[model samples]
Target: TVPGIGPVYTAGIVAEIGDISRFKNHNALAKFAGLTWRQHQSSKFSAEDIPLTRSGNYYLRYYLIEAA
Candidate 1:
């Protein structure tokens, strides 16, 4: 078994994402779970990116955060 992942957390993540290989990379995985932050920009200057996107699976996000 992987370190730091107990049964419940592992089960929850697996249940949410059936096939991990479907994601091309970590960014894809994060996007699927809605854990990526939004890119903010104005006319001439790009704003500081600080907020997470509202979209994504809340359950998966919660589990991922908990695992971290």
Candidate 2:
């Protein structure tokens, strides 16, 4: 069992992320879960801090965050 992830959260995450083989890697899975940081680089100016994209499976993201 995961630290904070209960059965419901695990089920939700599994349901939302059906067929895990579809994703190429963990990065792809993270992107699908909307847990990736946004790109804040432009030419010579790069931002040190960036926010999450928040663009993907809402339920999955919610469960993951709540579990965390």
Candidate 3:
């Protein structure tokens, strides 16, 4: 077993993300999964309590949090 990666979840994640290579890097992957936190910036002053955007693959996000 791979830590928290249950067989069923692994299958679902892999099936959802057909081509991992489509993502350029880890940041891209996280963004696709909706795991990246949002940011609000203005002339070098940034907000820290911004919320996460709901514009990504929810299925992938579920698996990611489960794995964590």
Compare the candidates by lDDT and give the number of the best one.
Answer: 2
Model 1, runs deviating above 4 Å: 1-3
lDDT for residue 42 in candidate 2, whole number 0-100: 83
TM of each candidate vs. truth: 0.81, 0.92, 0.85
Q: Write the per-residue lDDT of candidate 1 for residues 1-68, one digit (tens) a residue.
A: 87788999999999998889999999998998998888877788787847888588888988888888
Q: RMSD for each model, in Å, please?
A: 1.8, 0.9, 1.3
Order the candidates by TM-score, highest first — what do you get? 2, 3, 1
Instruction: State the lDDT of candidate 3 residue by residue for 29-65, as single tens digits.
Output: 8899998887789999999888888769999888877
Q: Largest TM-score belongs to which candidate?
A: 2
Better structure of 2 and 3 per TM-score? 2
Residue-level lDDT for 51 in candidate 3: 86
Q: Candidate 1, after superposition: displacement of residue 44 in Å?
A: 4.7
